[model samples]
Target: MKIAVITKTIITSFGLLILLAPQRTHAQLVPQPWVSVGGKDGDVTYSVGARALNWGAELGFGPDSATGFDLLKFLSLPVVSPYLGLGYYSEDKGLAVSGGVQVGAGDNLFLGVGYNSVRGINGQLGIKF
Candidate 1:
């Protein structure tokens, strides 16, 4: 009987702690949209992408038109956030691999440079809310 009472009290205390603790919203669910322009073999490629929760999806328009999806892993850093991603592109572009470092330009703006297997070296500009 004593053990049962103690268990109930502990559970109540934990529940109260959980209820009173600060609540954090998952901001990573908000997508960060970016535009990129790149060149390969004298042809220009334009692409747009959005990232959320360490995942990204992109659509490319230009010579090598394709749709791609990527899983992004970000490194914890001070000024710059560097990421590496592995993806697959449609339209015969095959496997896509990319790496980039993004630097915050201002409060809500970021700039990046990355290289994609199908898109070549690209510059990225994005905004985060």
Candidate 2:
């Protein structure tokens, strides 16, 4: 248990350090690992990965929702990072929403659950610049 805590702390610290470090003029961006717990179409599904750049995506599976995939990234940032996500492989076909802060911290990650949402939880697993 202590080891796990320490590992998490170290990982978090590393992530924060990278986040706080000075930026390079042409440095590449990476994805951040993020996990979310929520429901879709009244069914539960959790996302467990992320990708960097404007061409990255995520993949995860759930019981009711089954296997799912998404292609989303920062498209617009007006006080919040707006993204375009397309989800499929669920009972209700798929969902399309394009007005959420899908990029960066301080943004809600647990926005979908127990409702008519597509992704119950989606993790941002890397950075992109």
Candidate 3:
């Protein structure tokens, strides 16, 4: 019941973003490559990923290591951009649902915090190209 409500909310939100994005001429799809290293279950885990447009994918490693693919939609907001993702984690853990906000520090730098159902919570510091 809760998951169904959340999924509906996300789909509705993304639909709105798609409908409204075309009105903004300055909007650009920036390709970003990122590396994240954090701990899961007291062991170090890492991921390397790339994002373009409203989609992203990563390969994660640790005790509960898995390859994950996600669809992310970023809100067009100043200072902070909020995003949400739903992914399948294939390996030791099954599925992962995550969401986070990216705060820009410079042209190519941002910081993020996210939670994954299979891996718990993690922080990410990444450089966007």
TM-score of each: 0.68, 0.48, 0.70
Candidate 3 collision pairs: none
Worst 10 residues of 2 by lDDT: 108-117
Winner of 2 and 3 under TM-score: 3
Clashes of each: 0, 11, 0
Tens digits of lDDT, candidate 3, 1-129:
999999999867775664355324555477777777766678776776666654566666645556666555566466676666666777756666666666788988878777666555667777766
lDDT of candidate 2 vs native? Answer: 0.47
lDDT of 3 at 15: 54
Which structure among the candidates has the greatest lDDT?
Answer: 1
lDDT, candidates in the order shown = 0.71, 0.47, 0.66
* Model 1 lDDT per residue over 1-129, tens place: 999999989856654553344423453678888999988788887878877654566666545566666555554245676666667778888788777777888988888888777777889999987
How many angstroms is residue 89 displaced in model 3 relative to the true structure, after the best TM-score fit? 1.5
TM-score, cand. 1: 0.68
Candidate 1: list runs displaced more than 4 Å: 1-29
Q: After superposing candidate 3, which stretches have Cα over 4 Å from the reference? A: 1-24
